[model samples]
Target chain A: MLTKRIIPCLDIKNGRTVKGVNFLDLRDAGDPVELAAIYAAEGADELVFLDISATEEKRKTLAELVRKVAEKVDIPFTVGGGIAAVEDVEILLHNGADKVSVNSSAVKRPELIDELSGRFGSQCVVVAVDARQVDGQWRVHLVGGKVPTEIPLYEWVTEAERRGAGEILFTSMDHDGTKNGFANEALAHISGLVNIPVIASGGAGEMQHFADAFLKGKADAALAASVFHFKEMEINPLKAFLRAQDIAVRL
Target chain B: MKNIVIIDYGAGNIQSVKFAVERLGHQAVLTDDAATIKKADKVIFPGVGAAGSAMSKLRATGLDRLIPELEQPVLGICLGMQLMCRHSEEGNTSGLGIFDADVLRFPDSVKVPQIGWNRISGLKSDLFDGIRDGEFMYLVHSYYVPDCPEAVAYTSYGIAYASALKKDNFYGVQFHPEKSSTAGAAVLKNFLETVS
Candidate 1:
């Protein structure tokens, strides 16, 4: 049986983790590599390093961080944020990051999906879509879900799958950081529409929220940032809780 | 010291596999050079990506022909496992024919690419030495090889399929042992130390 995955998403800025990670036991919390190693040791199914670096030099620093993490951590990981072109993805993958996620750059150039998948194979290309409800309709948002676009969430995911996306990381801007829950209805809808795996991002508050994401949302994987970072929930116990819920989890 | 060479034909993430070996206190080199691969004591054929292009790359570099003929213990991972089979439903690819089986895609009833951790059981190979049945391993692929005589292990999503296969000098696993954490690291260690 394939078990549901629990991924810890770390927002990296200038090669250091940006979000407030409250691991009291750690010597240095800002070091993304150290945090990643801790997460891997804690049995995180996978890790996502979202590089929010703006300058090109910082991007190089991100790549170096990825190499270090890959060298130390045995588990798989994906790198994202500001991946606009093939070279950006190539450097990351070459540095030992397993997969590369693309968001606004993919929206800016839909063909970018086709090109990355064609070149690196869809398995290594993760298409991340940020969407929120706009006047009763889910509209794709840009600039980290601040700016909205006319593209429907369902329509874009279907197109992304067609464009050879191996997986879809859907973030509901409305549900994100709400501590309410995931966009289950939208996630189920996307799952029904596309053949690829769907990763539910945002709106993760508690263990039950994760269970809801898997049982109700039908998400292949669930990604959370602050909860895992701030030590609100531990991964192993969460997986144990999910397993007790009869949801298959890697224990 | 063993000369471990990871066959790098530019298809998948070979670096992780090399790092796994390094983690086990062994140094392995990544190369497409035929002479180097032939001289290695243990050969790792790891790939991740489409089978057709991977096979094409293997053929282009003449590694396809060189692989089956090598006398050393050869282990293939994921798409590398698929390419070792006779054929794949993906890309209508013809494989290296090392394993007397056919690669297949999972049914639509389940997810397309069976991502995340899955259990492998019915362990019958030294490749699975010290690894318990029902131990979880990370898997990511759309295509798989059905149960066959060469199957050393199996994983079930909707149906039981060959997750790991072995035939004499060649071994293949559908899961990414390098990324499977401790159990994965142990599996790789077994391959390096046990499968001779």
Candidate 2:
């Protein structure tokens, strides 16, 4: 049986981990490579590095950082934030990233997903959707959730799957920082509409939230940032909890 | 101290395999040059993407014929492993026939690509030397090789299947050791140190 994945997301800016990770034994808390190694050692199923400010110069730095992280960590890693073209995906994959996530750029040109999935396998492509509930309907948001689009979340996710997106990372804007819990209602709706694996993102407050995402939302994975960055929850104990709850998690 | 060569047939992430090899204190090189591959201490056939395109690339580079004739130990990863089989239902493609096994797509009941960590047991080869039964390893594939005589380890999804195979100098694993953390690194280390 395939186990549910626990992913730790690191925000990168100017080649340094922007979020202050609270691992005591880490020699350099700001170093993405060191933080990634720590997470791997803690049995994180995967690691995601998001380049918050992905300028051309910063992208080069991210690539170098990816190479450094891949050398030391044996688990799968994903790179995202400003991937706009197949060439960009190529560069990251060549630098040892197992998968690449695309957001605003993929929405700007939906064909970008087709081109990427065609060049690389669909498994290499991850389409991240940021959605917020507006007027009782889930609407897709762009540009870090400041702008909204007419396309409904359901319609956009269905089209993304049709376009060969191997997986969907759905983030609920309303619940993002609230940490109340995951938007299980919305996650279940999206999971029902698509066959690909769905990764529930945002609003992960406690370990039970992860379980709810898997049991109720039917999510294949759960991604969290601040909780892991601040050391509010460690991965091993979380996996143990999930295991005790009859949830299959990689320990 | 070994010169490990990762065969480059223009498919999938060879960089991770190269990095993993180097991380183990061995020099790793990626090349399609026949001479360079022949001279290496060990060879890794790493691949991703459709088997049809991968096999075509191998034939185009003439590595398909050379691979079977090589006497050194060779390890195939994921799609690389499938292409070494007798046949693949993917695109009805013919394989290198190194292992008398056939790759078939998973039934509609389960997820198409069984992605994430799954435990492998019934280990039989040095590839899993120190690895315990039910140790988690990362896997991502739409098709799988059913139980065969060459199987070295087994994993179950909808049915029991050959997760790893060994036939003399040729070895193949459906899982990605490069992405499987400590247990995966141990598998690769075993291949590098024990297979020869």
Top-DockQ candidate index: 1
The pairs that clash in candidate 2 are: none
What is the lDDT, from 0 to 100, of the residue A84 in candidate 2? 91
TM match of model 2 to true structure? 0.96
B1-196 in candidate 2: lDDT tens per residue? 7888999888988889988888788878889999999998899999988898898999999998999988899999999999999999987999999999999999978766777899999999988888999899999888999999999999999899999999999999999998898889899999898888
Give per-residue CA lDDT, model 2, range A1-251, as digits (tens): 88999999887878777643221122223678888999999989998898877466977888888889888889998899888999899889988899999998999999999999888888888899989989999999987677899879999999998998988999888888778888999899888888778999989889999999999998999999878878899999999999999999887
Off by over 4 Å in 1: A20-29
Alpha carbon deviation, residue A228, candidate 1 (Å): 1.2
Off by over 4 Å in 2: A19-29
- Per candidate, native contacts kept equal 0.79, 0.63
In candidate 2 chain B, where is summed lDDT lowest over 10 consecutive residues? B107-116
Question: What TM-score does model 1 score on chain A?
Answer: 0.95
* TM-scores, each model vs. reference: 0.96, 0.96
* Per-candidate RMSD, Å: 2.7, 3.0
